[model samples]
Target: MLTVDEHGLTVSAPWRSSERRIVGVIRDAEDWVLKKLDVWNAFPARKQTWTQDDRIRYLGRDLSLELTQDTIASLATLRDGDRLQISLADPTHTDSVKAAVVKWYRRHALANFIDRIGALAPRLEVPVPRLFLSSARTRWGSCNARREVRLNWRLIQAAQPTIDYVVVHELAHLLEMNHSRRFWKIVASVAPHYREACAELNRMGLYYMDI
Candidate 1:
């Protein structure tokens, strides 16, 4: 298992494995681990410098963020086609642009999550859980004991299938909180191709997408 934090990862080994073997393994994989960490660290800097060439993914499609200025009259930022049209006192202001983009993501994330959960909950024969969109950096989704499901707004950048997996995964938790075999069985029942979807989500990697 991977235990990660500000210090990066700590490789947890099987109970039967020796400490020496685990240390040797970590040492051997050190270079690759460092490279992955570097990729995560570099993205925040890139996200801050939002040039027209910058990209954002929507429903798994990568689209360039083309910023347009509107000085004719004051208007709220709006999306037309795949780009954002910003109207404000300063169109080039980084903070204002970022805020508008974030607002757009939040609006879409809530709508998409609600749609997916509304569709799947009926299939499971469970009452629809209250949905909440989160800005969590690492977690994609979570379900509390209250049956409230929280999905990361950044997931709006992923594909529809990936979003379905996360929704179904959390819905299954309404039946089983722990990640047991029974919990996975519920997930499989609701989403038959969940295994493939989960693998795709892993390969996509969370940190690669800027929130």
Candidate 2:
């Protein structure tokens, strides 16, 4: 389960386990969060180390990793690396705030993608599944059998070419679900520089969380 620190305004995810790992995030002078741990019920002791990389850390804790102060700084700095607007809606609870901010980003990103698809579909003679913002870790975007498309909201943080390439790729799949030669022909016709965008998008994972 997830819980926000009432006093510090921190986001926490706790698991049922013997070892406990707690993570925290400091949003600003007025806000900080201490997330609870969620894992198995038992664990052994372990050594701990610190780093400046701005990531979660775990020390002598069963979960093995917790969010560190440096990680919070990193998250704040990452809000708009690609020039997209940064907006976060945090709930009163700490854990809810993390979920809320993520959901807000995803919803808005999906809305923008859908709007763009509507504008481009008629001109290009290609249609795609309705785009939905989601926290899908395995893919930047997906096309289902029902002609529905799911896109990661984090795509908004990527470059424009990356976003466009994914959109075009998903749309092409609506015509041909498989990545066959015909599929490439359709995508290439719409986005001549898609290969470059795909390459960059593939690298974006290095910079973000599961979203």
Best by TM-score: 1
lDDT of 1: 0.72
Model 1 residue runs over 4 Å out of place are 1-48, 71-81
List ranges where model 2 is wrong by over 4 Å: 1-97, 209-211
Residue 144 of model 2, lDDT score: 82
Best by lDDT: 1
Compute the lDDT of residue 49 as modeled in candidate 1: 54
- Model 2 lDDT tens row, 61-134: 11211223332222322322222222223212335334433554565576778876786565558664566775
Clashing pairs in 1: none
RMSD (CA, Å), each prediction:
5.3, 18.1
Q: Where is model 1 poorest over a 10-residue stretch in terms of lDDT?
A: 1-10
Encode model 1's per-residue lDDT on 67-128: one tens digit a residue: 66776653434356565554555657877667766777788889999999999999888899
Each model's lDDT: 0.72, 0.50
